[model samples]
Target: MKRCLDEAVLQAYLDGELSGDAALETQAHLAACSQCAAALNAAEGEGAFLAAAFAPDDSVNVPTVQLRARIDAAVARLDAQPETNARPSGGWNFGALLASFTSLLTFTPQRAAGFAGMLSCVVLAALFFSIQKPSPAPNSPAQEEHMAFVTQPPAQPKDGSANVEVKDAPTAPTPEINRSGVPIQVAKFNRPHASKPRVKAAPVASSLAAPVASKAQPLPGEKDYEQAIASLSTAISHGGDAVLKPQVRAQYERNLAVLDKAIEETRLVARRNPKDKDAVDFLMSAYQSKIELLTTVADQAQVAALGR
Candidate 1:
């Protein structure tokens, strides 16, 4: 930082590439170095000139009179063509229909009448079928058996209590009889407040589940990367925001979010199939990129502190 700053560095500074303390150092160096200050002014002038040269022209003149005239001419041409009550594309064309009708006149009256009657009958039949909806098929004996509602006959009390009528409860589901005359038992649902004895699950042998557990476990390399990332994150959180400018901190946060999402997605893919080389590669790449980003910020902070 003591040496004269290069034009490239100055350009990066002017372009806002130098963030947090790095930007402060550049500002301090520019203040003390008159030569650099002149160079900065020259850079600013060039930037302004380039921006002005590339600026879009807002004074483009549209030929309203010519456009209006062309539109009006098109409308006049459309109006000159006869519509003859024909549709634009899908419906029958009147001009073609007129030619067909003229050709039809060459046939004798009786032949023409017979042809017209046959065409009318076909058209009527098609219209009738298209307008009507198909009726549902009648249920067979098996379907009737499944769908029939069972109504038990009234029963008297077995205790001979003056013929008390016993009826099926309204809340109970209607049981249906199968084709073999066996009554199908309706599945009864337990009430929400019903207390039931919990059956202890049989102990699963470790050997049976060992392979699945091992498969779910992360690799040694991934574990190391995760530990390193966690440590770096903790260090950055301690004073990173204080050292970073608002804009730089925001940019870093956005980058971290994107990297985190990519890492999570790729990690799932890799976990689903460890043999997938592409997925493993993508996961590792995301981790590496995140590491590089954190490393860059940490180094930049360190360098800026040394300069101070």
Candidate 2:
């Protein structure tokens, strides 16, 4: 029989990873061996010490009432802020904020005062501009021309001769001056045309017809559907080509061709009769079907890569 058990064998025995026979033998050895028993005691004591030292701190745990109060305060602050400023729920980091605040306090009062004065000056200038009545801007070249039309001087007598009888010009398409001093070209709608228009815009049939039942209850999680399709399409377009076997690639191409044909036909129907709700629904369904197929192909490629 061996005089002593190896340290590694004793460790395996403690961990219960040894065979049943080895475990029994180790048990018998520990019974007779004083040094081995002492080593085991020491190992257990070290483990207990480590577990107690590194365990979670109960003091750091926030109370439910305090946490709720903090969350309510955050929500109130977010509501008070402008829409452009973000109000994320899980974005707080108290440690980082404390560090930033400490750094800010390190600045001298004089430096801070200089910045504050500059800000005050800016606010005063803004208030002055807002309250003061702005002087009228000089007339532009276009405005000057428009003013001439409105303020035409009366015909003067040439030395002794009476002023020539000035008749009004023909009422043709000419630019007229508006109150804003901008020249507006008065468009003549009554143009003597030889023939009517060759092609006219199609009238909305749905607008003319009576209202049908509102079948357009919003699609739940429509944003999720769009996001998933976009992510799958991007993944497939980039690295998926490298993972695809030749046979799988050929199959995907054939399926895609079929989907493309269906999409084209449905889109044509939708374009022809935009007022037809059924046609629009068919078109959208076809697009979604195509996106689903693309996602499946990309997922298959991803699984193959993982297996490899």
Looking at model 1, the pairs that clash are none
TM-score of 1: 0.31
Model 1 lDDT on a 0 to 1 scale: 0.75
Candidate 2 colliding pairs, count: 0
Name the top lDDT candidate.
1
| RMSD to native, candidate 1 | 41.3
Instruction: Tell me the lDDT of candidate 2.
Output: 0.68
Q: Write candidate 2's Cα lDDT for 163-193 as tens digits.
A: 2444444457878999999999888655454
lDDT agreement with native, every candidate? 0.75, 0.68
Best by TM-score: 1
- Cα RMSD to the true fold for all candidates: 41.3, 36.8
Q: Write the per-residue lDDT of candidate 1 for residues 3-57, one digit (tens) a residue.
A: 8889998899989988879889889999999999999999999999988886665
